[model samples]
Target: MAKEKKYESELLITRIFSAPRELVWKAWTEPERVMRWWGPKYFTSPICKIDFRVGGSYHFCMQSPEGEDFWSTGVYLEIIPLEKIVCTDSFADENGNVVPATYYDMEEDFPLELELTITFEDHNGNTKMVLQHIGIPEGITQELTKQGWNESFDKLAEILE
Candidate 1:
């Protein structure tokens, strides 16, 4: 009999922005603006392919400071224009095909994929953005992912400004 491994992990981030919900939504839907704040600081994302409707896909390449580039692609499960978006994200090769095996952040067993749900709400004149990440591998990897997302949102706010 084979032993069954247990998997557990989740991340949630809530942010209140001083911008309207519509503008915030546009930043996410528009490719040019999204590229400006899609990844971590010092990492520039120059390549972006966005299809804002349901069942569409968003793909991009993030270039690190040392000229190393990483490719990430995701398929939009749901998109409620100005309200919410749900997608499944994964690390991919140059042809956008998911690699059969990969090491992430030095964790050989870490899951290279995650499901993300992003919600935007209007709070008076301010916008509240809630991001929920599920299915990430456990331990330090999850924590690192949360921090990375927070930093990305911080960058998003700056771009919105």
Candidate 2:
């Protein structure tokens, strides 16, 4: 049999915060904390909701510096407390209804749904978080996602501090 093909994510966001694993997980799972650092620089997350369990859902809205609003929703596929989280992320309306990727210009080649696998590891007393986004084509989504995550992580670090 031919070797099974694997889905290699072209976009990955990794950050190690000077905080405990549990605290790092809380920053991701807690809507209130997520609202503090969930968008790119100059962007703000005015709304954030997280169920934070297997099969549960999360939704949030990010307002751009230009005042345009963008919403994103996700369903948790797997969760291991402070260890790992797998979820499906997509553009959505305020009602949490999934919309076309093109609606947000998130992707041009890949499907609307993006798979995100986030892992948190304890590095001494700090937390190492890795966010791997699967199905990110070589386009705007990749750059925008990276920029957003990086900005978010910076905010998270400040929060942890």
* Maximum-lDDT candidate: 2
| Off by more than 4 A, model 2 | 1-8, 105-110
Per-prediction TM-score: 0.88, 0.90
Q: Model 1: runs farther than 4 Å from truth?
A: 1-7, 100-106
TM-score of 1: 0.88
Give the clashing pairs for model 2: none
Query: What value does the lDDT take at residue 75 in candidate 1?
Result: 89
Predicted candidate 2 versus true structure: per-residue lDDT over 1-161, tens digit per residue: 11111144458888889998989999989999999888978889999999888999999999998988899998999998789999988789889998876787544445567788999998877999999987666567568778878988898899998
- Please provide, for model 1 over 1-161, each residue's C-alpha lDDT reduced to its tens digit, 9 standing for 90 to 100: 10122125678899998899998998888889888888787888888888878888888888888987788888899988788999878787666876532622455554556678999999978999998887666677778778777888889898777
RMSD of candidates 1 onward, in order = 3.0, 3.4
Best model number under TM-score: 2
